[model samples]
Target: MAVDMKTIEHLCSLSKLSYDEEGMEKVMGEMGSIIDLMDEIKSFDLAYDDTKDGNEIRFADTREDVPEESFPTEKLLANAENTDGCYVVPKVVE
Candidate 1:
């Protein structure tokens, strides 16, 4: 893949990223290498029927929801620096 400096500079400007000549050259080289690697991968023989068993095909492990014991409001409120029969938080607005 041939990377143009003008295109790279344009992309950098669009992304609001500052890159000097050296940095631009480095980035262009890396991007070109990545594109070449993708091109190589595209040459591979990929068939759906050739697929085998799934590896680490995981599912969410969940449990039935049940009623749980909770602390008394007074006990929880006692730990607060300031409370009005509920949780206390810093005033957000004047």
Candidate 2:
């Protein structure tokens, strides 16, 4: 991972982050090491088994969904603008 200032600057702009020169140097070093670690992880070997139905294997481990008691409607609506049991938002779609 050959990191350069140009790449870091571009990444910073995309992430809406700003840093001074010294801070930029520190961030670049940390990001370079992270990228190097990710590159190293690419070398790991793992086995994959496609003979089983993954959905059924996972379904047996899931807990059953059960309905539970809820808070009073008045308590939930106390701090927000609401109408007819729902919060009102400004319409953004035509």
Candidate 3:
């Protein structure tokens, strides 16, 4: 599979990346090497068993659902610099 300039440009655009001609060429080369490695791996066949029936996978017991507790309004409001009933941070956007 040939890695063309258009394909590289499209990939960069999707990633919101800015690259000059040299950077683009370098990225294209790296991508080409990766694709080549994948192609090589595709030609190999391994008959490895992935069965997990007998193996015990230990995991922590999940937390049980409990009644939710609400914090006091006065306590919560005290933490806010500018509060009607909630915490307020600096305005980030217009």
**Against the true structure, whose lDDT is highest?**
2
Candidate with the larger lDDT of 2 and 3: 2
Residues 1-94, model 3: lDDT tens digits? 6588899899888999978989988888889888877898776797657684556555556565797889888897896789866677888986
lDDT computed for candidate 2: 0.85
Local accuracy of candidate 1 as per-residue lDDT tens digits, 1-94: 8778887888889999978888889999987888778888777787565356565445565555788889888997898998998887998996
Per-residue lDDT value at 50 in model 3? 68
Best-first order by lDDT = 2, 1, 3
- lDDT per residue, candidate 2, 1-94, as tens digits? 8689999999999999989999999999999999998898778786667766455557767778888889988788888865657777777987
* lDDT for residue 26 in candidate 3, whole number 0-100: 89
RMSD of each: 9.4, 6.1, 6.9
lDDT pick, better of 1 and 2: 2
- State the TM-score for model 1: 0.39
Sort the candidates on TM-score, descending order. 2, 3, 1
